[model samples]
Target: MIEIIPVDTPSLGDRSYLGTDGEVAFVVDPQRDIDRMLRLAERRGVEIRHVFETHVHNDYVTGGPALAAATGADYHVNAADPVAFDRCPIEDGDVVEIGPRTRLRAVATPGHTFTHLSYVLESPDRPPAVFTGGSLLHGTTGRPDLLGREHTGTLARAQYASANRLARELPPETDVLPTHGFGSFCSATQSEVTESTIGLERRVNPALTRGEDEYVRSLLAGLDAYPAYYAHMPTLNRAGADAPDLSAPRRANAAELRRRLRAGEWVVDLRSRTAFAAGHLAGVLNFGLDGNFAVYLGWLIPWGTPLTLLGETPGDIAEAQRELARIGIDRPAAAATGGPADWAGDDKPASMPTATFAELATVRRHRPVVVLDVRRDAEWRESHVPGAVHIPLHELPSRLHEVPDGEVWTHCASGYRASIAASLLAAAGREGDVVAVHDDYDPHAMIARFAATGGSGLARHPL
Candidate 1:
C-alpha cells in the first residue's frame, strides 16, 4: 500500500507530505524544521530517498535540501527555478519509478508561480493522488498576486487553465492534495472543506466552474495584502536553508531584557492574551501563544530585527522558535521564562483593560471613544464596526501618529489582533488611552446591539 502523510504547519497554513511504500519514501515541500520529517521517517521505518519542492516558495524556507543531504536523498526542484544549490532538477512530463508498484510524475501547474509543478503519485490498482502544492487548492486556487501586481492577471489566467488542465487530465477520483488554502494567504480564498478530489473540485472550485476571464477578474479583485515578510522568503528559499537551530537561546535576565528593549529590539511576550492584557513588562509586545502567534508575529515584527522571546515556560519559547524558524527566522537572540514579574524586575508592568463588544456598545452611550479597527483592509471592506477608524494591525506601528487621541477600543475579526494592537499602543506610551476588545466582532449583530442601546444603527448594515 502507498501511504501518504501530511506534516501540517498550521501556524503558516501549509503542509508538507511524506509518501511511502512502507520501505522507501519521498517528501514534498518540507519546512526548515526538518527534524519533524526525520523523526516521521524514522518512526515509519522508511528510508527517505527523495525530496521534492513544487516551486520557489514565498511563505517559508524549504527543507528539501537539508533533508536530502541528511538522508543522502536526491533533492528535486523545478528545473526552471534558479535555486543556488545542487539538486535533481525535474521538469514537467518527467516520471520517476518509486519501487515496483509506485511511480511519481511531475506535472507543470504554473499558476502559483511561473515554475510551479504538482507531483502525482501513481500505483497500479489505486487511484492517483496529486500533490498540488499551491496550485489547485480545495474549492479555490493559490492567489496569483504573490509574484507582483504586474504578473497577477497573466498568472490568474494561467491558474484557471492549470486547474482545468488538472481536471481534464487526472482521473475524477484523483485525490486533490494541496499545500495551501488552510487559512494561508497564498490561497485565493480559504476553504474549510478538508478532503476533496478532482471530480469534486470541478463541481465547486471557482477555477473549474467559472470562465477564465471571470475567474481572473474575481481572483485579482479579491487579493489582499500579504505578509511583509514574504518578500524575504523566496530569497532565503533560493539560497537554501538548513535545519533550524532549535537549541535554547541565551537566557536573558531582567536587566538584559530591559537593555534589549532600550536598544529598540523586539521583546515578545508569549503568554495567553488574558495574561498579557492583565500585566506585561512595558515595551514588551504581546504575540501570545494562544492564537495564530507565529503568523501575526512574523507579519508585524520588522524583518531581521533582534527578537527576544519572553514566555511563562521554556516550552512556550521553544514552540515559538519552531514556528518562527519555519518562516526562516533561524534563532532568537535570547529567551526568558517566568511571569511578568520576572521579566519586569523593579519596573512596573503595564496593563491594558479588555472589553467585549456588548460592553463597548454600553460604554459608547455615555462617553465618546475611538473604535480602532485593526483588521486587514479586505476585512474592513466586508463589514466593520460602523464608523470605526481604519488602520490595519500591520500598519499600526508606522501609522500610530494618525490615531486620534482618545480612549481607543481596538478590535479585529477576533480579539487576537486587538490584543496585539493594544500592547503596541501601550508600548508606544499610550497605555492610558487604549482598551483591547477581547471579543469576536460581528458587524451586523453589533449594529443591532448599538440600535437597541439607543445608538445610530441605520447607517450600519443590519441582518
Candidate 2:
C-alpha cells in the first residue's frame, strides 16, 4: 500500500509524501518541514529514496535538497530546467521503479514553470495516480503568470495546451493529487479540500472548461496579488539557500534584547496564546510561530524589519526563525536574550487586560471602549462583534487617526491581527488601552459586560 503523508506548507497546504510498497518513499513539493517527512518515514519503516519537485515554487521555500541531504536520497527535477545541482533529471516517459509493483513515470507538464512535470504512479492492479504539482489543480490549472509579462502570453498559451493535453491523454480513472489547495496562491483557485481525481477535475474544473483562448483569458482575470517576497524566491530556490539551523537559536540576554530593541530591531513573539498571556517581554508583537506563521509575519513585519524572536521553548524559537526565513524574512537579530522574568524593565509596556465576553458586556453596559475590528470587509460582513470599528489590518497604519484616543478594544477572527494592530497603536504613542478579544468566545457577551459598567460611550460610527 502506498502511504501518503501531507506536510503542511507554511500557509499553502500542498506539500506531501508518497511512500511506496512500505520501504521506499518519494516526497513532492516539500515544504520546509523536512523533519516531519523524516518522522513519517520512520513511522512507516521506509527510507526516502528520492525527492521530486514538480516545479520551483514561489509561494514558499522548497525542501527538496534539505530532505535529500537528510536521507541521502536522490533529488530529481526536470531535465529541461537544468537546475544547478547533482540531481536525477527526469523527462517524459522516464520511469523510476520504487518496488516490485510500484513505479513513478514522469509526464512533462510545463507552463507553470518551463520545466514542470507530473509523476504518474503505476501499480500493477489499480488505476494510476498523478502527482500533478502546480500543473493541475481541482478547479483550475496552475497560473502561467509566474514567468511575468515577458512570456506570460506565450507561456499561458503553452500552459493551456498542456492542460488540454493532460485532460485528453491521462487515463480517465487516474487520481490527481495537486501541490496546492483551493486557497493557495500558487493556483488562481485553490480548493479548501486538497486532492482530486483527473476525471473529476476534467469535468468540473473551470480552467479546463473551454477552448484554449477562453481558458487563458479566464486565468488572467481575477488573479490574486502575489506575495511581495515572491520575486526573491526563484533566486533563493535556484541557489539552494542554506537550510535554517534549528539547533542553534540566537542567544541574547536582557541587555542585548534592550540594545537591539532600542537599535530599531522588531521583537516578534511566537508562542501560544496561553503561553504568551502567562508571560512575555514588553513591547513584543505576538505572531505565533505555528501553521501559516510565515505568511502572517510576512504581512505584519515589513520587509527588512530587523527581527528578534521570542518563544515559549527553545524549539519554538528556532521554528519561528525558520518560518520567517521561508518567506524571506531572514534577519533574526537575536532570540530570547533573557527569559521573560529577567527582561522585565521600565521600558516594558504595561500589560493591558484582555476582555472575556462577560467582562466586555459589563464594560459595554455602562460605557463602550472603541472596538476596532481589524478583519477584512468580507470577514466583518459575515459576522462581527457588535458596535465595533471596522478597519482591516492592512489599512491600520494609514487610518490611525480614525481611531479615537480613549480605550480601544481590537479584534480579528482570531487574535493575530488584533495583536498586530495593538502593537502599531502602542508604537504610535496612542493613549488608548488596546485589548484583543478571543474569537472562540461570544463577542456579544463581552460587549454587554462592558456596557453594564457605563464605562464609555460608543461614538462616530464611520462607514
Candidate 3:
C-alpha cells in the first residue's frame, strides 16, 4: 500500500509531503527545517529515496537540498531552474520511479514561476495524486506576480493554460495535493477549501470555470501586497539553503534586553497577545506566537536587524526560531524564556490597554482619539472604520510620521495585528493612552454602535 503524509508548516502556510510505498519514500517541497521531515520518515519506517522541488520557492527557503543530502536521496529540481547546487535536473514528461507501485511524472505547469512543474504520483489500483507545488492549488492557482510585475501578464496567461492542461489531461478522480494556498501569499487568492480533487477543481476553481481573460483580469485585480520578506526568498532558494541550525540562541538577561532595545534592535515577545498587552519589557514589540508570527515580524522589522526573542518558554523560542529560519532568518542574537517579571529584571514591565469595538465606540462618544487601522491596502479598501487613518502594518516603520499625534486607538481585521501595532506605539512613547481593540473587526456592529451615537463608525469603499 502507498501512504502519503503531509508535514505542515502552518506558521508559513505551506506543506511538504512524504509519499511512501512502505519501505522507501520521496519528499515534495520540504521546508528549511529538515529535522521534522527526518523524524517523520523515521517514525514511518521509510528510507527517503528522492526529494523533489516544484519550483525555486519565493515564499520560504526549500529544505530539498539538505533533506536529500542527509538521506543520500537524489534531489530533483526543474532543469530550467537556475539553481546553483547539483540536482537531478528534471523536465516536462520526465517519469521517476519511486517504488514498484509508485512513480512521479513531471507535468510542466508554469505560472507561479516561469518553470513550475506538477508531479503526478501514479500507483497501481489507486487514483493518481498530483503534487502541485505552487501551480494548481485548492480552489485557486498560484499568484503569477511573484517573479515580477513585468512578467505578470504573460505568466497569468500561462497559468490559465496550465490549469486547463492539468484538467484536460488528468483523470477527474486524481487527488490534488498542493504546496501552498493555506494562508500562504503564494496563492492568487485565499482558498477556504481544505481539500480538493481535479473534479472538484474543475467545478469550483476560477481558472477552470472562467475564461482566460476574465480569470487573468480578476486575479490581477484581486492581487495585494505580499510580505516584504518574500523578496529575499528566491535568492536563498536559488543558492540552496542548508538544514536550519535550531540550537538555542545565546541567553540574554534583563540588562542585555534593555541594551538591545536602546540600540533599536528588535526585541520580540512571543507570548499571546493578551499576555503581551498585559505586561512586557519596555521597547519590546509583540509578534505573538499565537498569530502569524513569522509573516508579520518579517514584514515589519528592518531586514537583517539583530533580533532578540522573549518567550514564556524555551519551546516558544525554539518554535519562533524554526519559523524564522524557514524565511531565511538564520539565527537570533539572543533569547530569554520566562514571565515578564523575569525579563524585566528590576524595571517594571510596561502594559498597554486592550479594548473591544464596543469600548472603542463608547470612548469615541466622549472624547477625540486617533483611530488607526493597520490592515493591508486591500482590507482597508474593502471597508473600514470611518475617519480612521490607514497604515498597513508592513509600511508602519517608514510611515510612522504620517500618523497624527493623539491618544491612538489601533485596530486590524483581528486583534493580533492591533496588538503588534499597540506595542509599536508603546515603544514609540505613545503608551498608557494607546488602546488595542482586541476584538474581531465587525463592520456591521461598528456601524450600529456609532450610528446609534450620532455617527457612522464604518464606511464601505467602492471597488
Candidate 4:
C-alpha cells in the first residue's frame, strides 16, 4: 500500500506531497520547516530516501537540502537550473524506486520554469498519481511570466506543449496532485480545490480544451503582476535557504519594537484587522495573521528589509515566523507578544479611525474625502465606489502621489486589507487623514445606497 500525504501551509494555500510505500518515502516541494516531514517519516517508520522539486520555486523557500541532510536523502532538482548548490541533478525519463511497488519517473515539463518537471508515480498495488509541481495544475498551469515578461510568450508555448505531454502520456485514471493553483499566485488561474484526476483535467483543463495558440493567449493575458518577493525565491531556493532556525528572531519588549519601528524596520502586527484597528502600535503595518499574511508580507515589505513581528501570543509569533520564512523573509530581528497594554506606556495607544460603509457613504457625499478602494484590480473591475481612486493595496506605496492629499477613507472586499492600508498610510504620516472602513460592509451595496439615499443612509438598492 502507498500513502501520499500533503503538507499544507494554509497561509499561502501551498501544498507539498510525500509518498511512501511502507519502507521508504520521497517528498516533493516541501516548505522550509522540515520538522513535519521528519515527524511523518518517524511516525510511519520510514526513512526519506529522496526529495524532488519540479522547478526552481518562485514562491516559498524549499526545504529540499535541509530535509535531505536531516534524513540523509538525496535532494534533486532540474539540471538545467544554475543553482550553486550540491544537488542530484535530474532530467526527463530518470527513474527511481521509491519502494517495492512505487516508482517515480521524471518527465521534463518546462513552461513555468525553463526546467519544470512532472513526476509520474507508478504503483503496482495502487492507482497512479502524478505530482505536477507547477506544470499541470487543476484548472490551469503555473504563470509563465514569473521569471520575466520577455519570456512569457516562449514560456507559454513551452507550457502548452508540456501540459499536452502529460495529458497524452499519463493514464486517464491517474490522480493529479499539483503544488500550486489552489489560491497561490504561482498559478496562471486559480482553482477552488487542490485535488483532481487526470481524467477530470482531460475534460476541463484549458490546455486540453483550448487550442494551443488560444491557450497561450489566455495564459499570458490572464497573468497578473506577481509579488516582488517572488523575484527572490528562485535564487534563494537555488542556493538553498539555511535550515530554518525557529529559535532566531528572539522575543523583544515594547521598547525594542519601538526602536525597530524608528529604524524603519517593518513591524508587522499579526493580529485581526479589527483588533489592529482597535489599537496597535504606532507605525506598524497590519499584515494580519488571518488573511494571506505571508503574500502581503512579501509584497509590501522590500526584499531583505529588517522586520519585527508583533503577535497576540507566542503561538501567533511562531506561526507567523514559519509562514514568513517559507517565502524567504526569515530572521526577523525580534518578535513581541501581548496587547497594546504591554506595548503602550503613558502615551495613548495608536488607533485608526474606522467607518462603516454607511458612514463612509455619508462622509464621501458630505465632505468629499477620497474614497479609496484598496481591493485588487479584478475586484475593482467587478464593482466599486464610483469616483473612488483605484489603487490596489500593494500598489499604494508607489502610487501615493495619486491619492488625494486630504482625508481619505479606504475599504477592501473586507476590512482586513483596508486596515493594513490605513496603517501604512498612518506610518507614512497620513495618520490624521486616513479612515479605515473596518466593517464587513459591502462596497457596491454602499454605492447603491448612495444612489438611493443620496449618501444619507443605507437603503434599498436603486438603479
TM-score of each: 0.98, 0.78, 0.98, 0.94
lDDT of 2: 0.70
Give the per-residue lDDT digits (tens) of candidate 4, residues 193-274: 6679888888999998899998988777677667888888888887887778777468788788788888988888899987
Candidate 2, which ten residues in sequence have the lowest lDDT sum?
454-463
Q: In model 1, where is the ten-residue run with the lowest total lDDT?
A: 454-463
What candidate 3 gets wrong by more than 4 Å, as runs, is: 452-457
Model 4 clash tally, residue pairs: 0
Q: Candidate 3: lDDT of 389? A: 92
Clashes of 2: 35
Q: lDDT of all the models against the reference?
A: 0.89, 0.70, 0.91, 0.84
Supply the global lDDT for candidate 1: 0.89
Between the candidate structures 1 and 3, which one is better when assessed by TM-score? 3
Tell me how far the alpha carbon of residue 195 in candidate 4 is from the true structure, in angstroms, after superposition: 1.5
Point out the worst 10-residue segment of candidate 4 by lDDT: 454-463
Give me candidate 2's TM-score against the actual structure: 0.78
* Tens-digit per-residue lDDT, 254-304, candidate 2: 778778767767877676544555566666666765535676667556668
Which residues of candidate 4, in runs, are more than 4 Å off?
439-447, 452-463
Alpha-carbon RMSD, each predicted model: 1.6, 5.3, 1.1, 3.1
**lDDT order of candidates, top first:** 3, 1, 4, 2
Clashing pairs in 4: none
